[model samples]
Target: MATTAQPVAAREAVFVARALCKTYRMGEVDVAALRDVNLMLHEREFVVLLGPSGSGKSTLLNILGGLDVATSGALHYRDHDLVAADDAALTLYRRQHVGFVFQFYNLLPSLTAYENVALIAEIAHDPMPPAEALARVGLEARSGHFPSQMSGGEQQRVAIARAIAKRPDVLLCDEPTGALDAATGVRVLDVLETVNRELGTTTLVITHNADIARMAHRSLHMADGRIARELVNSERVPALALSW
Candidate 1:
């Protein structure tokens, strides 16, 4: 992917969603998860999505990462139409291009850190060595440790290494620090910031913590399944400096 800042047009954006809609039907009623959502994520940019519970932040992230299809309107990954993609196409797109980290560490309990990360690298089209990826998150010494043997922050860092081992074009993180304490959460955020800055990966992070917004280039606020507002930081505060 081009690291230099090019003009981000609709066709040129890493991800684009225009008038996107998603609704889930229960036995008798339908719940609208997203409503005419419009969004664009530029290549190599770090953006944070802030919202209350059930504000559709996770839904939007899932759609952007090809993990779920939109109900209606245009959702594009570069020139490809995500809304029109079949399950196979979406799977292919996710496997080949996107990296994901979620709230839980989700590491394989039976595997050591190295093995857990190496599993993805083995299948990636272009992958950094698993060891190198681990080291990127400051986990070189913990390569032999299993998730159960590490602290919460360490496990989260290992999970991050596994996600980025594929050297994906985009990293979609949903509440990556939600499971950790404040100090540990800052550590995870630091690793995320490092990945974005060093590897030039476009990152979209979803978090309920409003204080986390200061670390992002642009903060998007979601409410009732729509993006209610956006705030750009004049100067991004380091994760360690965050009050929360």
Candidate 2:
């Protein structure tokens, strides 16, 4: 069965960042995580943020997901200004618009895959049924299994299912495959690609692996907390097509 495409525009900006800066204080020392970052993420775009450790890729994702507030910058997600948002507004924004996947699966060990996914749907405003979400990640048959009963790749797929089940407008993934071996990592990435293509979630993946950049519609390289370069892939490769 063919999947429908995501709409290109939604009559408003999905993300807008200007002169964004993020700084952290460790005792008397200050660390600049992001500096003078400017970016615009649109609906349904599959973007990859690539950089080494301390390059600020994860910081950018956190700021976008509303998990962390920028120290100095202007960020607008649709009509909501993230910099000006209160804790309650940020919570609602995260609940209603953002879905997150981290390097760790973070699934409950005792809950079956279906139950783990259902937990998110239960709290979501308008979520897809748990079984349907599992099917989307090619995990329907594994729904009955617990996290310990599944392979790392399978567990990550379940995580992906849980994130997408909320029908979020933006999906933020930080080193999503970082814990898996290369082979398993590829499988997890395949699921993420499928989610982006099939569901049209505006997906942003943060990775240090340059190989994964080929799978993105657009790739942004970060350095010293700023976007060093941005490239549009004329021919994007699906994750399944990647070797290594």
Q: What is the per-residue lDDT of model 2 for residues 4-77, given as tens digits with 9 covering 90 to 100?
A: 33344453457999999999998999999999999988877888999889899988999999999999989999
lDDT of each: 0.90, 0.90
RMSD of each: 3.5, 2.9
Q: What is candidate 2's local distance difference test score?
A: 0.90
State the lDDT at 182 in candidate 1. Answer: 96
Tens digits of lDDT, candidate 1, 1-244: 1123333333247877889999999889999999999988887778999999999999999999998988898988888889999999998899888999999988999999999999999999989999999999999999999999999999999999999999998999999999999999998998998998899899999998999888887899999999999987767788778867
In model 1, the runs with Cα more than 4 Å from the true position are: 1-12
Name the regions of candidate 2 deviating beyond 4 angstroms: 1-12
> Pairing residues by index, what is the TM-score of model 2?
0.94
| lDDT of candidate model 1 versus the reference | 0.90
Tell me the TM-score of each prediction against the true structure.
Answer: 0.95, 0.94
Candidate 2 has which clashing residue pairs, if any? none
